[model samples]
Target: MRFALLGVAVLAVSLFVMSGQMGVPSDLPFPVQVAIAGAAGVAAWHARRSWWPLAALGAVTYAWLVVWPPLLVASYFAGRTLGRGRGLAAYLGACLAVQGVSALVGEARDGPQEIMTASLGNALFMALGTIGLPLAVGLWTRARKETAEERARRLEREQIMRAEQVRAQERARIAREMHDIVAHRVSLIVLHAGALEVRTTDEETAETAALIGGIGREALSNLRDVLGVLRTPRPDSPAPDLSPHPALDDPDLSPRPALGDPDATYRPQPTLGDLDRLLDQSRALGITVTRHDEGDPRPVEETVERTAYRVIQEALTNVHKHAGDAHTDVLLRFADGELEVEIRNQRPHGHPENLLGTDLSGAGWGLVGLRERVELLGGTLRTSTEESGGFLVSARIPA
Candidate 1:
């Protein structure tokens, strides 16, 4: 709407200037004058795209018919568009040449005496009005536009910096809480598990206690890694030492291998290849699980495998919590360009309430975290109750 109004204003002003010029004596016919006025309006309207063409036409008309308005508009656009070098110099030179030509034509008609007096004064007035004033205003407009864009860019950069600062502070706070609370508790669980393993006389009980202690120590080590990342100054920095802290060491506990050690027990990220071990752990807890594979097995990206493993891990954990002793079916379908993981458990033999009680019924954040993990890999996770009173958790991930 603003541009339409501007076009209308330009046309009106062009016609007004042309009409006023018609009163002055000229050899050009009336229709020719009207056509030139129409052309001037069109040139002014399109001056933003290429002002040089308008400048050329305006220079000719200004010299021949004393049409100054179109030339003035063209000069303004030229100032806004042209650089302050060869382009601007050439335009000023052309304007000077046109002024000289106009003066010569006037002298030829009105004689040297009038040219020296009135022509010189009129030439100065025309130069100031047609070139100087409009050109200055156009340059000012260009400067203002550039300033506004710079300010917007600066504000955007500041906003990003502020957001990063807030995220860093939040990460630090979480790390502190986990270190003070979770780390301490897991350490104690590891110590107790170690003591249990030593005191047990039965071979199976000692083995189970050892497994618990190993799992607990691995958990503590992983928590240390998490805290290390949160407390790091930058993401690209070297990882902190993965060895257990001296404070967490216990004489009853066997030494776990440090990261980078040849016999390290901890794997930073688990993949689908680790699914067997996970299944064995569940089976050891007395859950009947059957595994099925569909389609030809193929190598998948490590990240995809990790997310897939997590989906199944979280699902089986849910099974243990809510559907104890349930027969669970684990399916891995490798399709053309995607991998599908489905874990479905049949109805438990006993009431879910009587299974493990509420002690194992976690805070329900595991499924939420699993969903986020799957979606981050451009995948989908779904959980629903089966018609057979079973629970189904499914995930589809891009390979």
Candidate 2:
């Protein structure tokens, strides 16, 4: 508003001086003309922000004839920029005030008779030309600028939202990969260490194996704690239980356990042959899972078997989380050079409600981790909602 006022004042003063040089309104002193222009600028500036200021300015402009048309023009634009209702109000108020002031001044200077003789139509013509058109143009420009700015701001917000989503997805992917790879290996180490401690007969060897087992258990505990921090679980997810282990939690034990003899060896890990055992365990837990082996069962590379097993394991895990009692079907198809595994679950019925129910819906990166694992083994996995309102997960890997 200040800038607009300043610009108008400068322009008006320049024009007035130029007109004075041409002997027009030359009777007014130079200083008086500058003051009139300044007042006009100030009034115009106020007009843009509020109707009251613009109205007051309009009255003052009417009393001061030297700043007539510019004041009127400024008020019109101010009104248009303000919007139709307010702008029109300002424009009309200024116009009427100008005419009223003009009439009173004319009566005082030229007498009531001469003032009444002047054509009222001519005043109306000047007001329409000077104020009406300028106000309309200003309003149009203001509306256009506002619309463009709104669209740009909306797009900027959407772009920022998309970037945030991508960052969240990447964070989840990293967390899942760490859990799948590191947790599996660490679990194996813990298992082997425990077996060695139980089997060793010599006191020294047994003590060393016991130490290794203690370290592995502590490591596993620490790993779970880290996962708790990384994976922000949903409301329904069970809180991780990090209860102290009786053997590993001895107060006399060193704060950090020393590395013992790393002689514990893991047994050949379960491959696809052990899937029947997995299904049996699920069945024991009251989950109905039917398995089908298509084509002649044949041996495959260790990596392929391991990946296939993990895929089914993850699928089963997800089912247990969402709907533990749901019936599921597992299919293992062996082709010439490829092995395909499919696990589908009927929509969840319901689980027995309890405070300590088997709800292990931890970090929701199970599927994401499984996909990455499968892809790493040159396999493709697809999961989708079934038309029958169930769920389907399928994976194919080069055998």
Candidate 3:
């Protein structure tokens, strides 16, 4: 309602300013302009739905009085904001009603000119008030609305893009954990299964191998889901050669001879006592993994031993790919209540470091997870490129 009064005051002041432009007389008296303005405000204040109608009437009246008429357009624009569609119609209707009043007023006057001439001029002025002003105002409203919606949609799209980026990061992290945990377990299973296959010929022994194979198949399935559907691509594609998810496939355990019953997975843990024998075991696979020990002997926890063994196993697995023919050295040290292990390798001259057929850059969190495992046990882990074109990982865990 207050807006209606402001609209009226704006219209009158504009008319006062442009009075010379329209050549309208100011003899209507200050009190008269105030009364007309008040009446228009009263009509519009409570009836905002139809305020444009009354303002449109005010514009027509101003035109008949020969005052600056452009100011009438303000009320039309203001009414559009205060009210919506119906206000425009109401404003137009009110303008016509005011024209009727003007005709009656002309009939009562004693001007020398014919009333019909003045009446026609008043009607033309009414058309400009109701039609010209409202048409332009409605168009302005439409354009404003369109721009606002575009901004809203743009903001929404940006939000969706940010959310998708976050989701991708989370998926990568999940995929990393799955690959690390599953790979470590599967490697051991394969190692032990190979052992069992060699030393056993009994039907029961065959049955166990079948079970291990079953487990491997299940692991492969899990890895498939956690990783991407397409791990590697066709030769024709330019995409990267990487696993989309973790490997759940069975571990490679084909080397076990059918001679010894060394069921070591769920029994007394495997440790350095088994290291000497294990090196000989890996050598049979045509992979050279030399071990070196230094520093004084120290007592360590069983968990640390198992974790250490698994770390080396993975390192060797990576070597089988990257340095199948590389001279590899495994160093273990115990000193000052700490246990440290360092694995370093130098590929044989002119041999490809990527002999395993797996992409090494894809080995990101494989080492990171191993490092985290070590750190969780109050340990420190470090990996860096060796000067001799080799790679080294050194880990130290408190005893």
Candidate 4:
């Protein structure tokens, strides 16, 4: 709006000056000239974004300054350029309109060629009038439009980035929720299993105690697998694999104590402590359970200690569930700074029984939790059925 006012004021001063040099009557009726000037002023005032007003005011301004030939030509070109393309076309039509009016008003005053020949200045104005001002102004307007468009694009990109940041934060929050739920419930199960094992001595109760130990070890393994995503690098490892433990399930909240758990007096969690007993329990279910050791059972960290216990626990549990009345081999290997535990059992020819009465639904989560636990302690776990019809789970944990 300010710029429109400025352009109009500039045009007015130029016209008044040119009017004098062209020798138009100073005594010309103030009323007629004022009326023309008022129209130009109004057009300029309304030219906020509409090209019509700019074209209209510019056309009229040129028509009134007839004698000072340059002003007439400048006005025509300026109007056309002010609104290029369709606007320019519209401006040309308006110019022709103003020309028609001047022709009518001065029909008796002078002839057309005579009007052109009257001034040498008009000829010079025509050459520049053809292209100069219009082209320059058009490019200026195009550049201004481009700048505005770039600014809008930048704002849109910023909005998308902010939205993505919010979504990532939400995903991390959900991941945290899942971890807490599994950890809390599985820990409670281990607690009870440890307590019951301590107080039970009857044969049936002893079997139940062995099963509880197996389940607790399964839970610990599952917890490790789930937590594998957060595996931190140890100085001796390039890629840490928390091998032994796997996955977890929530039900009946059984208890199995942790390695060094104060509730169980930090007793060694079922590691080598129950290898013979684990075989006895599996064999009692009529599954042929065998054992193997590759190297000496030497000193190892609690992380390795607990993971080893969990691996054997889940393997035997799987045999109990899916390979009842089948041959099972439990192999332990201590090599380098790592301990490897492998459990392989033949797939039964018939439908397998529970062998023990724990929920099968709860059994599925075992491997996943085991992997998490193993990875967290710089270990790796692999499980699949072998070509000979046995399911095999193998884990190696750093000591």
Candidate 5:
């Protein structure tokens, strides 16, 4: 819209100037003068696209009638579009040639004395004021615009680099804290569990101790992988080695996957297929848990399945903490284009205060982490207490 207005303004000014020049009594008819003025206006309006044609027309008309608007407009646009190279040199050469031709035409009409005195002086002054000034302003404007754009791009790249540096520093700090606190505590738990497994005589007690120790060892392995990642220089590097390190090694612990194996670095994530084992683990801990399926089962993306599994795991963990031995139901409904997971638990049998023992209490970030995970996959998680005093946790994820 602005460009259209600019074009119209240029055309209007060109017509006004041309009309003033042609207003003097001449041999041309009034209609012919109007037609010539309209043509000059149109040429000035389109000077941006091809300024040379307008320049040529303006030179011819100026030599004959001493009109200058179209020539000034063409010179401004030529400076804007043409760089300081051969193109600009060629245009200046043409302008000089037009001045020479105009001088010769003036000498033919008036005498050589008039051409040498008043005519030459007026022509030089007009060329400097109309052409040189506008051309210089156009070139300066273009240079200023190019410099501002380049500075803006440089600032954007610098901002990105600073952001990455802050993120790397934060990751390194977190890795150090986790290694100092959580890793040390987990290592001690694994050692204690290993001692219990070796010293126990009863078969069932030994088996339970063995299971506890195995779970602790696996937790330490996963923690080590996470720390390795946080310590790496680049985020896109290959996964860290999963083989047991000397600091975390135990003779009684079961063997882990071999080092240097192609699949060792990329461990399989838990999915819906592992839901049965998860339920069994809760049942073994004396929790009454049951699972039900609705609608037809369909395969979904691995990320969706992983998030669903985590939702159920975190919900069950909450049940153990807040509803001791409460009846829990796990529902999986596979519907068109989506999968829904719901875990509902009955109210605790005893006082809630008694059920929430210090050992079973958590840091309370499980649900928050689960919500982040679900939302990242374009899903929603909801948790609420029912009127009957039961608690419900549900997640809906796109397949």
Candidate 6:
């Protein structure tokens, strides 16, 4: 579009120069004037795309004749687009070349006295309107454009900085919440599960209880890893090349392997297949757990599986923390492109108590984290206390 405008301007200015000359110009022949005008049009096209071409074309055309409007326009654009020193040199050189050629041509046509007077008058007019004015305007336009671009870039940089600051603050907030609240609840669950291991004499129960305790400890470790990522200062070096959002088919969702431990292995994440193990762990703790699955139980997305497991983990942990000895029922329903998990427990027989001596006063951040995890996967989580007397936790997630 801009080049088209330049083409139109070049044509219009060239025709105007030709018409304005009429019969008054005689230093150059009519054929040479027409040829120079054609060259000026070509120069205009090249000038818009680059300064070097304009500089070269301006030097050629302006040195030959005085009635070339395209050369003046091209010189102005070269000045605007090129570096300050280079642009100024090109503009001045073209102007000087024009005056030098006019003087030589005029001297050859008439006597030096007659030619000098006419050339001086022509040079003065050209200097003010053609050469000096265009250079000044181009320089002014260049300065204005550069100033506007700088301002726009500064605003963009500021916006990106502000966004990064906000993200850092949010990460810090999540870290604090996990430390103050989530860590406490998980610790209690681990402590209680460990207590069950010692208290139970039944071999099967002890082994199952030990497994649950080990799982809880592992969870605590992973939780700490996540916390480290949130709290640690950003690395000075570039982050590892990894996808921001891994494909659903991707087995690993972590952006990169944990730093400083090539020997350290990533633990397998829990999914629906691990649901039985989770229920068995709770059962070993002397809680009555009933699980039922409806619809053909098939494989689902990792995120959906992970979130569903987390929902159950949180629900069962709450059962241990706040509703000891309660009869808990877990329901899994797989429907068209969705999976739903519902956990409901009957009223506790008495005061809340865990296998551990801890008072079981939950720190309350588990549900907060659970909700965040679920919503992040484009799922909805709902929890409520039944009027009949118990708590219910539910999650509906994409499959």
TM-score of each model, paired residue for residue: 0.82, 0.45, 0.38, 0.36, 0.77, 0.57
lDDT for 279 in candidate 5 is 94
Instruction: Find the 10 residues in a row with the least total lDDT in model 4.
Output: 232-241
Q: After superposition, how far is residue 134 of candidate 1 from its true place, in Å?
A: 0.6
**What lDDT would each prediction earn against the true structure?**
0.76, 0.64, 0.59, 0.60, 0.74, 0.70
With a 3 Å backbone cut-off (N, CA, C), the pairs that clash in candidate 6 are none
Provide the lDDT at 201 for model 1: 91
- Tens digit of per-residue lDDT, candidate 1, span 277-342: 999988887799999999999999999999999889888888877788899999999998999999
Q: What ranking of all candidate models by TM-score puts the best one first? A: 1, 5, 6, 2, 3, 4
lDDT by residue (252-359, candidate 3, tens digit) is 422221334333111344566667665664565556788988987766788888677767766766776666667779999987878888888775457654344355
TM-score of candidate 6 to 2 decimals: 0.57
Q: lDDT for model 6, please.
A: 0.70
Listed per model in order, the count of residue pairs whose N, CA or C atoms clash below 3 Å is 0, 1, 24, 39, 0, 0
**Candidate maximizing TM-score:** 1
Per-residue lDDT of 1-399 in model 4, one digit per residue for the tens?
Answer: 684665577446544743464334333466666555555555555544444554545544445444333233344335434555676565556555665554444443454422532344543343235334554555576667779899999989999988877765664455456556765566666767667777777767766766766766665654544444334222233323333222233333423335453323122356676678767766766678788888987888766777888888887877767666778788989899889999877767574432333466776688899999999998899987676666788998887
Top candidate (lDDT):
1
State the lDDT of candidate 6 residue by residue for 118-143, as single tens digits.
47786576656666778778889989
Off by over 4 Å in 6: 1-72, 83-129, 136-144, 147-216, 233-260, 263-269, 293-300, 321-329, 344-372, 382-394
**Residues 188-222, model 5: lDDT tens digits:** 88788778888989888877777777777777767
Q: Candidate 6 — worst ten consecutive residues by lDDT sum?
A: 241-250
Please list the Cα RMSD from the true structure of every candidate, rounded to 1 decimal place. 4.3, 17.4, 14.2, 17.8, 4.7, 9.4
